[model samples]
Target: MNPRTVLVLGASGLIGRFVTDDLRARGFRVVGAARSLAPAQTMSALDIELPILALDTAALKRFLGKHSVDIVVNCLGVLQDGPGSSTGAVHRDFVARLLQAVADSGRAVRLVHISIPGTADADRTAFATTKREAERLIAASGVPYAILRPGFVVAPSAYGGSAMLRALAACPLDLPETEMATPFQPVAVEDISATIAWLAARHIGDASVKAVAWDLMQLEPVTMAGVIKQFRHALGTAGWPLAAIPSFMLDLGAKIGDLASTLGWASPMRSTAIAELRRGVRGDPSAWIAATGIAPKTPAEGIGRHPATIQDKWFARLFLVKALIFASLVAFWIVSGFIALFVSYRAAAGILIAHDFPPAPVDPITIGTSLMDISIGLLIVFRRTAAVGLVAGIVASLGYMVGAAILTPDLWVEPLGALVKTGPAIVLMLVALLMLDNR
Candidate 1:
């Protein structure tokens, strides 16, 4: 093991995962920690030997006390913070908890917290608010710390905003371009990881850098449309033409997205996301370059360096496929429920009666089952209850199939193959359940 040991929290994330790899390449013994260990385990295939540990307050304290960690890099963050995962708890409170644990252990662990630009804006979102709170906590803790406020961190494998960029660029459908002129100083993810590694080596003890924050931005500012166009060009497919769309249309889309989110869709076109994009991300990189003696790559250079691979192209194309699949599944359940409850009530009741159900209770059973099917559809569409809904769907589909098999055995081999089709429906529910896992 190397003399220096670093613990990277949220190490399975876009930035943290790359940071772990970069640190390992730099010869530091890196311990990657996240809320779940399964995603971290996949890193083993990359030949990056690091202890992937599951994180919690108690486990973190135990690990810190046991391991001689020289530095602690917190890459933990979330975009849409809510009930199951609160931004206040994960960003602000967690930092305080980690700091208190380290203080209790009497270890001078150099803390490097990842934050984003625009936290100082007047109309900051919950994400920016929580990040700012975390920064304040680290500053007042009397612990050696370096807060990194990076602007538009881009990586090879895209998610969230970056994924949106790719979608916009690679879109085969004609899209109206709104807020095309929004400026951003995009910095490569690898550059951000390299900066973190540099700080880890120095133990962040520089007189000019202690408790100070650095804005890791590129040298040039590019418009949002320019970045997308550049990306398309880099992929060797810049032929797609973009037509100008009304700003109000974009605003309306964001509003619709906000409403959809309430109905359980994780649409990035939510009002907050749209507002953040319009706000744009720009910062002076002089402080960062002066301190680290490293100039980050420009937006064009960053995108050019990561040429579109076959996997990248496939991911870009398949993004819409996943969305379509989800929509189809939701529609099938709701429409089927409607057909059973209202459209084909007589037929459904007859099926129940043929299955030996009492004539008096057949109507009630049909109504209840129809409601359950609709509820399962709604639940599966939501991020929180998706797993429960998927499981319920699988069980219900299987039960219905088995019941039909016992009641109407001839339907399985009938010309229409009505009972045979349920097998694929059950399989699809299981497949959707697997895809719902964020890890």
Candidate 2:
């Protein structure tokens, strides 16, 4: 028989990308599916030559029918809730629709799904509820499926809580209070991919062992704060003292973050995420090892396998630096505008008058300029309009420098270098733009 054709959903995600590569290497014909073609082209580690299809239910069905797929591995998932999207829809509803499409086509496709280890059942939080619901849908869909529940998956490139851990490690801040430390069995992404590849290959022809739900976990579990210290050492950073905040505080912060997220902010610290953390991510790896005949590495071993690169170091340092730069830019403009309105109004009007702007319009000009500055700062604060805000900042900075040069040359040589300092201010704005791209 020809090699089994497998379609990997969420092919651009951290786990999905690795799973796609592993399946292809294991002599399976792999087709990667993602929400959009642009991210597939730019971010995915899947081969450029691999056939990438859309993730919509109808689109997936058409591709399956055309390709005669034997296995479908779903690596699709969301860490937090956002506008027009939620874990309920992305995790549960989408899979339900997918299973419905599969049943309608009458294809005997084996499904290998990735799920959270602790969330074997649904709960109140969106993360837990949708994950469990998806598992239920898979079980009831009549599609032969294998659910792989992984705990605290880690890779070279970090995101979500992993990134936060790295940040904590690289940070030099000292906290005065102690926080509750949760333990997790952090698994290697490679191990998860390997298990996924093995199951895809074996389940294609086997009817007896199809409906298995294995917990793919590490050999040992580590505390949350302890893991952060390990990652810090790996990044060549020294451990700093941390004050622990109560779990309830984390929940409250996450709740506030969720509200901000509705406005397009992508905070990993959502209430649902905090809830998941409190629940912990520990599971038995015995079943996975027996099924795949693969011995998974411990968390420390896994960390050693993927040695930190220069880029990892930069990411660790810049993650928080990016936020600082953004905040600084916002403050610079807003404070400058505030001062111009209250303290520098007369001086601002003098420039307009000296430049031959009508005297009657001088106050209006000053007020307009101050409002423009404050507005740009506010735009920079919100993620939805950050790009536009950065572009506007560049344009506004240039305009100010040119106008000041012609109209207020004396201010350039002032003791504070008020006009001359615009040069560095423009550069800072450029740096902020660069930091935003890192996201």
Candidate 3:
């Protein structure tokens, strides 16, 4: 008999990647689809780059028929609404269309949706409300469905909130006392995969698991502070004294994150994320554990299973610093232009005039270069155009260096070393470009 073929949407995500790999290893022919594929994912022939969200019901039906998929696992989700993301579109509309496509395809396809754990009253943010709506849609769609709500997913690869937690653990910092005390029950990624595998092993139209909604997480009570301390121990920084971060500072960071989101950056520290974090992760896992007979690992057991390598330490330390690096680069470019164009326009133009150049074009050249500098800074401020801006900044810096060497070679020996410092600035821009990818 041939193995069952499974299709995984959003296969490049943190949980989706692991689930795809795990299912394939267990003998299922897994087809992984994502909006964009990373360099590492290019090697997998089973992984296809696809914009599933944009597809209509008819198109999706064609896709399902083409793959002959027996099961569909939707791991696609966004932390909050941003420039390129819409919670309502992804969580509600997409699921509605998918349900229609599955029914229209005339295939016995089972949908295993990933959702959040919370009641209607706890749904303060759009992220939670939309997710809950998706679950409701799935239950009523007349399709074989299972909704698994995993709490505070802690996987080997970190992104968004998990990345933030690691950064906090690596540094000598902690959240405010009240925030730390919030309930934060965590679930291992392995347990999530195991539950899916168990469900797949059963017959497709099995009555036991039809239209089931289960919360997948450890039964032991854990708090945010406990989780962070476990991470600190894994990183060998448990003894480090942690300075409490002010609550106001967290709110300020969320506002800045919201601003960043408008520029196409999907920052995890947005107001929605803050509101959800404060609400805390709470759920009962007895039903899931009883059905699957799979025991979830506690925070200590999961985090301690593997020792932290140098790469782990480096990622944790650099997570928060990535924001600082971009902010500084933006400021550097804008301020340099502002100073030259407004503060000391005469001084800027005097260099060209003093270099024995024709007086006719000196002022225009000075003004054009200053405006170009400011333009690059503005481009870098938006996530969509950041790469173009960084590359342009590098080229412009080189042009200035070469032009100065030919025109005013004496400036290299100036007391401030202004001309000599352009080299480091160029290197910094290159660093920013390399670190731009969030996933």
For candidate 2, lDDT tens digit of each residue in 1-439?
8988888887766787777766777788887777644443343343333323225667657777887888888887877767656777788878887887677766888888888876445366777778888999998877889998888877766766777667767776421123335667788888887877777667455865568888887666676755665676677765455555555666676786687577666666777777777777777888778767888777677774455788888888877667678778889888888889988888877767876777787888899989989989889888879878888888998998888778777766779877677888889888888766423
Clash pairs detected, candidate 3: none
**Top-TM-score structure, candidate number:** 3
TM-score of each candidate? 0.81, 0.87, 0.98
Better of 1 and 3 by lDDT: 3
lDDT of 1 at 392: 91
Model 2 clash pairs? 177-243, 177-244, 178-244, 179-244
Segments of candidate 3 deviating more than 4 angstroms: none
Lowest lDDT sum, 10 consecutive residues, model 1, at 45-54
The best-first sequence of candidates by lDDT reads 3, 1, 2
Which residue pairs show backbone clashes in model 1?
Answer: none
Between candidates 1 and 2, name the one with more favorable TM-score: 2
The top-ranked prediction according to lDDT is: 3
Local accuracy of candidate 1 as per-residue lDDT tens digits, 1-439: 4668888887777788788878888888887776555543556433233332324566567778776887888888866654355667778887888887776766777888998776465547887788888888898988888888888878876766787777666675433454777777788898898888888777445766567788898877777877777778777678865566577877887786666566656666667787788888877788889988888887678887567888677666656455666677888888899999999999988876776777888888899999999998888777778888889988898888887778767667779887788889888877777666433
Which candidate, 1 or 3, has the higher TM-score? 3
Full candidate order by TM-score, most accurate first: 3, 2, 1
Task: Evaluate model 2: give its lDDT.
Answer: 0.74
